[model samples]
Target: MSANKAVGIATVVMVLCAWAYIALSREPRLPTSIANGRYSNGCCGTIFLHDGVMTVANQRVDYIIERDKAGPYVLPTAYVGASVHAVVVKFDAYPLKLRLDDAAHPHQLELLDDAADGVRYSFTRVNGS
Candidate 1:
């Protein structure tokens, strides 16, 4: 075999190997799974669900609870009384900017797991002073 022909074959084989490795290792993208009537600010954020638990990236510790029938209804109260695992994904410090949402304002959200029962009930703020 000619030297040039041998080199060409080797290059092609290397390229094919790299392509296969990337294709097989890539993770699947999650889809938006919020119910038709429910809303969430974390929609624009990344969510991960494992072992029947749901977690959102860049979540705020102080979350507001609101009502919407379309939502699956995970957390019912604003205080977050349960002993749940919470983390502050992002913040600027001093006058913290929390991510707040309700059925009224929705965002580009993704649902990591559909089977997880993360939320329990739905409660909206009282109307009128």
Candidate 2:
């Protein structure tokens, strides 16, 4: 094969290998159960995590959630640095991070502000949800 042909083949093979690796080793998916169902602060508003989508606000916005990843990544400094499902949402007020507290039982969650030193709320599941 000509030098150019050899180089072209090598490039295609490398690209295919890289793509395969990324596809095979993608981040683990978030559990729908942990954040699923109806949740509320009983003060500000409600959060719905149903059908693999999250829409939460005092006002109501259907936000599509993607890039759900396990953590140590999004956990606040106060946390014990354990791994759990975490996702970030961009809100009108501010960006927020939601972290699952318990992976075993998967009931409560932590809603944290975007601020480096920010407030965190323990959001609980509403009854019969």
Mind giving the per-residue lDDT tens digits that candidate 1 earns over 1-129? 999999999999999999999888733222223222222322232333222233444333333222333442333112221112332233333221112233334332222222245333222222220
- Model 1: lDDT to the true structure: 0.33
For residue 18, model 2's alpha carbon misses the true position, in angstroms, by: 13
Candidate 2 lands at a TM-score of 0.48
True-vs-predicted CA distance for residue 44, candidate 1, Å? 17
What's each prediction's clash count?
A: 4, 0
Candidate 2 positional error at 86, Å: 20
lDDT of 2 by residue, 1-129 (tens): 899999999999999999999988855544454455776664445566664455543233433222344551122212211112332343434333466655544466567644466566566777777
In angstroms, give how far residue 113 of model 1 lies from its true place: 15
Which 10 successive residues of model 2 have the least lDDT summed? Answer: 73-82
Query: How accurate locally is residue 44 in candidate 2, as Cα lDDT from 0 to 100?
Result: 40
